[model samples]
Target: MVEADASAPCTDPDIGNVAQARRRTRGPSLDKTAQTRQQIAEAALAEFVEVGVARCTMDRIARRAQVAKGTLYLYYPSKDELLRGVVEHALRHSAVYTALQRKKGETVRAFLRRSLLPTMDAVENSERGLLARLVLSEASHAPELARLYKELAFDAWQTYVQDLLTLAVKEGELKTRSVSRSAQLLASPFWMALVHNSLLAPDAPQKLALKPLVELLIDNLFSRSAGDNANVKSQ
Candidate 1:
């Protein structure tokens, strides 16, 4: 896992702050500047995919982005930092994680539809797809970053699944002694699929039929277990 200090902050330091103790002068074209930053990130992603990140240079990124190399540094201190920006941007706004919204107390099935599927959808984009593959291939070299990616992928799903089990326990729908264990069981297959897709099966069909796998997983692990959760929907 990325040690807290070592993990790069995901947002642009200048723009992400919501408030300050004292008001300061505001830039008139903040939105325009932010758009430019997004453009650079988009261009960098393309450049990195077209040429591997190891081969990509700041000069090339700048040329692709139509921004000065120094300007790119203003937004990102280093190439690694810039790459972090691209990955973070993809995580929050990409097709998969972006639309996977969940209501409080949502069921385990809802969790997958909201979070996992959208992430899987993102696997189809060339730039993001390439980056994801690169991470998988190089994770051994940078294990911390790899672990951070895993946490970003599934931590919330675990929490949401756990919450659903807790709800079921309160309703007398589950006989589980520990909600955490049940949550683990619920999220295991989804996580396993994520692992296979991200690392082991990078060249696998872009659009895998995960529902069948999900059904098999739920059937094998759940199978109307004595303590099985009733409120959590399975598909």
Candidate 2:
């Protein structure tokens, strides 16, 4: 498993606060500018998919967005920044982050279903699916994109999983020794489903469905045998 600095902030220093503050304080003009930036990002996604990232030029993106080249630069100073924008857009619009929204005292099943199932359905049908494919394809060449994916998406999901599992342990819903590793195991299959749907044969019939998988996982992970200690591994 690829490790990330858990202590690291979830958002990019260059993009997150500045833009968030602008949205909170600035009026219609900044809102309009934000919309324009989204337009450019969407256009850039189209251009990138049409002809891979290396060939997707700012000029082409501007034309596709029907905005001036200068206008596009005002939001994204470079293609890399624009790529981050695309990712941010995709993540903000997906249900993958809903795990972080779990209410205190909610059941493990409720939390997992609320977060995981919708995300699986969303990625299977939405532009986020295409975005995942695009990012994976470009990751080999653009390390920053991969880094941003970890920073913005993977780490946040893992952190939520860790928190949920920790809560489960305290509530006697789980008896895992390692919350971190258990969290990884809990989240891995859902993620693989998303990636498989995004990059593999999405429409093909699968032997396992996500709901049944979630049920079995919950049964195995949480249905601790009587007298099981904290050190007991789930079988």
Candidate 3:
């Protein structure tokens, strides 16, 4: 009998069915898909930063990502969509945006301080800061980006803070006439520091610190005794 050639394609029906089954089951793994998406997002952000949103193009982003243009489109169909994706991805992983639950017996003020201060301390040097700067710099040029930033970052944070303030009031840890305004006040320092560092005087040797300002605000906002004293003195 003649020996079968090992190099030849298998002709046996059982072997052919097995081979077909393997082929049908094969595709990009979940890890690979996620990695590719991450690569594309990073590349898009780099392009946006380097050339501004107006000048950045899908073709350029694809080249930067080292992915086929078609592949880039598969992940993000258009520049606007890609910008949204990038911002959402960045915000999702941001320390500042992570959802934190108040510990058992933790005051809302204490929780805010514990949760926000550390993140705020590093905001000026973190990816969160970079995203804020990008939104500020491009807001005038790209209205849609500004809108998305507001929807995804600004308004979301405002709502989150508002909810916390409501909780504080319900728990009797805070006494504010308006939870909305108090939340806005609590948020103002971060924007001020961001503008001071990134826009108004980026090259200045001395930069504003966000953490201390936030810490001070937290103390004042949560000080029931101080509020009481003020009411007593005003009478």
TM-score of each: 0.60, 0.74, 0.82
Tell me the tens digit of each residue's lDDT in model 2 across 1-235.
Answer: 1123213222333443335546766734767877887888788878777777665667777889998765666577666788899878877768775436656656655676667766755565566666767777887876777788788877887897788788767766668778899777766675677666545766767722455666567567765633444443332
The collision pairs in model 2 are: none
lDDT of 1 at 32: 69
List RMSD in Å for every model shown: 7.5, 8.9, 12.5
> What is the Å distance of residue 116 in model 2 from its true position?
2.3
Candidate 3 lDDT tens digits, 22-141? 366684677877788889888888777777877777777788999976677667766677889888877776776777877777777778888878878888877667878888888999
Question: Candidate 3 regions off by >4 Å?
Answer: 1-26, 224-235
Q: What ordering of candidates by lDDT runs from best to worst? A: 3, 2, 1
Model 1 lDDT vs. the true structure?
A: 0.59
Worst 10 residues of 2 by lDDT: 1-10
TM-score attained by model 1:
0.60
Off by over 4 Å in 2: 1-28, 98-105, 198-211, 225-235
Show where candidate 1 strays beyond 4 Å: 1-28, 95-115, 125-130, 141-144, 154-208, 215-235
For model 2, what is the C-alpha lDDT against the true structure?
0.68
Against the true structure, candidate 2 reaches a TM-score of 0.74
Candidate 1 residue pairs in backbone clash: 96-118, 96-119, 100-114
Q: Pick the winner on lDDT between candidates 2 and 3.
A: 3
